[model samples]
Target: MQQIAIAQAAEGMVLAKDVETGDNRILCGKGTALSAAIIERFRRMDISHITVEGHPVVEEGAKSLKEELLDVENRFSKVRHIKPLLYLKKRIQERLIASRRPQPAAKSEGS
Candidate 1:
């Protein structure tokens, strides 16, 4: 499944997880195919992201994860000497890598 920002979500995509409101009430359930109305509702509610059934976002000729790490390192080179800034850069790089990794599929009852 791919976790995508609300703006990236489109109609007919199956939801991989339940979408809940800030107060913990489920607005939509898992396996629900998104529609224009639902997408609009999510936008209205300002939901940041939701996990969908597949990799909907296409990356054509984009930098690989390693390349991205290197880019981030280079961008922070000037501030590397600053302890707190360096720590923040390291954390950002880690999050980038983690987010790019492919998530394992959820197990079904038959399995």
Candidate 2:
């Protein structure tokens, strides 16, 4: 299954394939809806810089989904912020990679 790298992801974009293990342990799956609720929350918070998930961070010209999300999540909220989202994305990717790793029969069975 091919998926756009997080750097290439954007808001309102649907994942193309299921991010899962050969044994079908899903880390992040295809057809997962972008968190539109978060967008609305930001809008309510008076944040105009909206970022979607899985997009590259551009410095200036135009903000990507991640960038916009970061700006709002970081600038407005004292609790939720860009770091958490980044961490979540990273953990998901790591799980996907780990799920793909070849494991011994014992490990596989345990999993």
Candidate 3:
């Protein structure tokens, strides 16, 4: 799931989490596919951000996974000799790869 600014949201994106009101009431449940009207309603409700089901929105100039992993490697190079630090670096890389994996799109989500 990815939390993104509501301005960046568009129609057809599925919600990964519930959108709640200020009083903790669910305005929209998870798996709700966004539509123009719903988005507009959210705007009027003062909602700033929401969690979407997948990494569907791509920003310009975002780094690829290879570049990101290389950056992690470079930063951890100095501590590669330290056993604990090396393990931590490995775990971080694992999580990055896991997060970047494609999620299966829901075909009947909105239906």
Predicted model with the maximum lDDT: 3
For model 1, what is the alpha-carbon lDDT of residue 82? 97
Model 3: weakest 10-residue lDDT segment is 102-111
What is the lDDT, from 0 to 100, of the residue 110 in candidate 2?
Answer: 13
Roughly what TM-score does model 3 have, to 2 decimal places? 0.68
TM-score of each: 0.54, 0.25, 0.68
lDDT of 3 by residue, 58-77 (tens): 77798878988999999998
| Model 3 residue pairs with clashes | none
- Measured on C-alpha atoms, candidate 3 has an lDDT of 0.83
Greater-lDDT candidate between 1 and 2: 1
Error of 3 at 28 (Å): 2.6
lDDT of 2 by residue, 6-66 (tens): 4434444544344444476654444444344533433454433322223324344854445
Q: Candidate 1: list runs displaced more than 4 Å.
A: 60-111
CA shift at 70, candidate 1, in angstroms? 20
Indicate the residue-level lDDT of 44 in model 1.
95
